[model samples]
Target: MCFYDEMKGYHWDSVESEIMNRSRDDVEKALTSSSMNLDGLMSLVSPAAEPYLEEMAQRAHQVTQQRFGRVISLFAPLYLSNECTNSCVYCGFNMTNRIDRLTLTAEEALVEARAIRRLGFQHILLVSGEAPHLVTLPYLTSVVDLLRPLFPSISIEIYPMDTSSYEELIKHGVDGLIVYQESYNEDVYKQCHPRGRKSDFHWRLETPDRGGNAGFRRIGLGALLGLANWRVEAFFLALHAQYLLRHFWKSFITISFPRLRPAAGAFEPPCPVSDVQFVQLLAALRLLFPDAGLILSTRESPYLRDHLIPLGITSMSAGSRTEPGGYAHETHAEAQFAVADERPPEIVAEVIRSKGYEAVWKDWDAAFLH
Candidate 1:
């Protein structure tokens, strides 16, 4: 069975209650546990774990060093389009928003790629809103084909597709796929995505499975914080990650932490996560999944991102633009979201060096697999 089927066994409220009921003793047991299971994760993310943040951070750091060493892989996001058909309430690219939309041609996308490459990014994430008609499979593959030689590693953060479609993208030199569930809570997910293909929660939930089946070397998953309770969201995300790790053993698994940010709709996060709680959740996830890659993005402020790097962040997006042709052309297209960390790639890399870790511009290449 897929994760959607496995997820049905546990109810949201029951999981939330279990986390809330965790006592300090439970937290202590989880901290010292050798095998970090979902129960250990629950106790670590629970409120009782608040008093032990320092301890957890220490353990998380040790685990991170053990698994990933003192290095952070840096990449840039090349926004191919801001056009979307989805009316996601939290997204700036919502179809209903009165914003300028643009989907780049292959040449325009290549221009953006050159700009990102000049910034010393050998790894690129191609981002676009879910505008299937405008950003079709052939269109995406063509752009990937044009960019195959420029970047050593290419990844996509776009719409979900069937397994066959994903396999075609893989053949076109795309090695990674990142899809966020936005909110794992079905009711919340439906409300956030009122109209669009994204409204089908189960399809989106099973996206990584398709990506994995299609042979993507890397599959990224995340739940947008602030849409639901952070602790409960963390629990469900960990559960999903565990499931993928078991079923898709060959594909490297990564998790992203994308907190809600201001965008076109001026939407506010209903269940905002505090900096402390965010730290707790990050530390908990690191302890639970030491080998998994935890990604931090430019959506968070530079100060926060800097302090968070040592806590378990393995990969980061530096010098990112969320609008189509943002790097190369002068366009009026609206960004999918405002970038919080505006530091240039070199500056971000220097900051990473200041923390005594190496900043890796590219960690994987297509040559390595062959």
Candidate 2:
């Protein structure tokens, strides 16, 4: 049975409403209190919590420095294919998009991996559109088998799969999985993903559950910020993260805040999240979950990334190419969105060093997992 079937009776909308209705006092209590629990997290994301941004930032910085020190983990994305079966309206790789689709063979994948590694990226995020027939478990496993010897850590941001499939990948050296809910608003989600496998909201919602069950070392969660009310969706994401943390304490958790970028077939954001608001949300997340990993992608400008690095961001993707076969084979292919920070990975590392932070290329060793 699907994991969502078990959680079907539980209502997420009611909890989201409760969080949105939080008061100033609750926000203050959450900010000042030592042991800020799940309720505290709700208040931090509430609208009334705007006034405590500075305080939250201060605590976030301290907590971040204390836990992670003056270090920033760096990684880059490798888009293997653009052939998708899903029709997610907000993405350029959607099946409906009329663009060139490319899937890398094992040799092609190695060529791209070598190019990425040459730039000193030891952590790689393997990405592909949702096409199970083309990007099946065996295909992905083969890619992992080839890249595992090159990169120390590898994570996937692809279509959702069953627990057994995830287990198979994990055994083949997949370190982590990042599966965003896009938005927690069920109606909006359904509207955004009109057809194909992506329309099944409950299945997408339960992806992390499946990952946890498969014994993944880490699972990343987030809502695409601009798609819905950042506050409400973030609250649900935090709740989901909290639930996973409580139930699967062994699995490390990370959160990414990817504001929507202009894609091939664009859709206007219902709720546009500003830079300041995004910072506030990041600070609040840090204050709430001090030990959790916060990631910023190349979608933000270099200036914004520099400012955010010290605040709470622990990991970042630099010089990302979102298009399929974007690195080695084709650079002018269709991209999911235009990357803001177009600087190369080495330049990004220089910026990190300028800020008195070490850019970590490899933190995890393959033997450690064994």
Candidate 3:
């Protein structure tokens, strides 16, 4: 069954109550358990687990070291367009917003790709607002065809497509797919995305399954924190990840924790997650899925990003530009969101080295599988 159907078996209220009712003994049991499961994840993120933060961090660190070693894979986001059809209230690219829209041509995207290539990024993620007309498959495939020779690893974070569409892109050297559910709560999801194609919650929820069937090499999943109670959201996200991992055993699953940030509409996170809670959630995810990647992006501050490296983050996006044509051109286009860590790629790599971790530019090549 698809995750939406699997999700129906568990009631949200019941899960939240169980998490809140966890005791210190439950937290200890989770920490000492040989194999971590969904039940262990509950104890690790509970209020009772707050007092065991240090212990959780220590265990998360050791699991990460054993599973991934001391390396952090780094990539940069190459925004292709800011033309969105969605009216997501929390996003800067909401269709109702009066921001300038831009979509890069193949040549223009190559210019940005070359700029990112010079910055030493062998892995690239193509980003755009959810406007299918502007960011059509023909347009995306053309851009990927032009960029395939430059970067070995290319991923896309755009509108969801059918399995055939994802398969076609994979044939053109696009091997990874990243989709954020925004919020796992169906009610909050509907309220936040009031209009556009993104409003179809079940369609979006089943996207990774399509990508998996298309044989994507990597599948990334996350819920935008702060939309609902974080503990509830995290639980659903973990459930989603667990479902994907079991069905799509061939694809590597990565999880991202993107806390809501300030954008054009000035929407505030109704349920803000504090630093301690964020750490707890991250470490809890690490213990639950030790081999799955934990990605930290520039939405966070530099100081916090630096400190979060050892916790369980296996990948990061460095020197990211969140708007179209940001790298090669000097456009005054408004960004999707303000970058909290504006340091260049070199400086970010330097900091990773100081933390005794190797900053990897490229870890996979299509040639290896062939």
Candidate 4:
């Protein structure tokens, strides 16, 4: 039986409704309360939380500064392939799309890794579409083996695999995994990912559990903002994060907020998230979980990225190229999306330094993994 079929009791619609019904007073109490829980998180994201954004932001800023200092960890995404079997409607790499498909060989991956290192990035996120036949466990293992010796830290933003597969990758030196739920609304998730392995919501939902079990160092969770009510979706993401933290206390956890950017063969978000609301959500999350790593991507404009530096964002991606072989072998292949902040890595590093924050390149050591 499928994972979802086995866990029929978990319904996303009911949770969404509960979040929608939260009152403003509830939001206030949650923001000011000495201890913030799931209920407090719901209030902070509900309509009732709008008036208290400033106060929440202040508390969040202080908390974030205390924990992470003024430095923002910087990283970049390296797209290895655009080949996918999944049919995610909101992604440019969906299988049905007629776009150039490319997968980096071991040498090609090393070439891209060198370019990333030259850009002063020690942290790298390897992204690919769900093409299990082409990008299987062994293939990923080889890629990790090749790149692990080059970059100290490597994370993957690829399809979900079994715990054993994850364990194998961990043994080969993979440190982190970022698997976004896209949206927790099951019906919406179904409508978006209509075909392939990604269609299984529960398998994806329980992926972090598997990752934690596999003894991976860190697991990242996120929602593609603009797909549904940002507040409701964010609440669920936070809940999932809390669950992972409680269950996997030894493993690190990070959260990302990726606003849906314009992409080929994808629908625009149903409810767009504005700049102010995005900042508010980030601040709210920082206040709720002071130690959690909050990451920003190149999807937002440079102005927004600059403004967000002081508002609780702890990590960022700079000079990102979303298409496969984009850094080393620029091709006309389809990118996951067009990156908004097109500044070169050096320029982005300069911006980060000007903001009085050191741009971190190397934070992890491969020797420690062994």
TM-score ranking from best candidate downward: 1, 3, 2, 4
Error of 1 at 370 (Å): 5.7
Model 3 per-residue lDDT tens digits across residues 1-370: 7899999988888998999999999999988888999999999989999999998999899999999999999999999998999999889899999988899988999999999999999999999999898899999999999998899899999999999999999989998999999888889999999999999999999999999999999999998988888888888899999999899998999999998899998999999999999999999999999999999999999999999999999999999999898998988677888899999999999999999999999998967433
Per-model CA lDDT versus the true structure: 0.93, 0.87, 0.93, 0.85
| Cα error, candidate 2, residue 110 (Å) | 0.8
Extract clashing residue pairs from model 4: 24-48
Weakest lDDT window of 10 consecutive positions for candidate 1 = 361-370
How many backbone clashes are present in model 3? 0
Model 2 regions lying over 4 Å from their true place? 1-17
Q: Please report how far candidate 4 places residue 327 from its true position, in Å.
A: 0.4
How many clashes in each candidate? 0, 0, 0, 1
Q: How accurate is candidate 4 locally (lDDT)?
A: 0.85
Per-residue CA lDDT of model 1 for 1-370, tens digit only, reads 8999999999999999999999999999987777889999999999999999999999889999999999999999999888898999999999999999899999999999999999999999999899899999999999999999988899999999999999999998899999999998999999999999999999999999999899999999998999999999998999999999999999899999998889988999999998999899999999989899999999999999999989999999998888899898999999988899999989999999999999998898878534
> C-alpha displacement of 223 in model 2, angstroms?
0.5
lDDT of 4 by residue, 162-240 (tens): 8999999999999999999998888889998899999998889989888988988889999999888888777777778
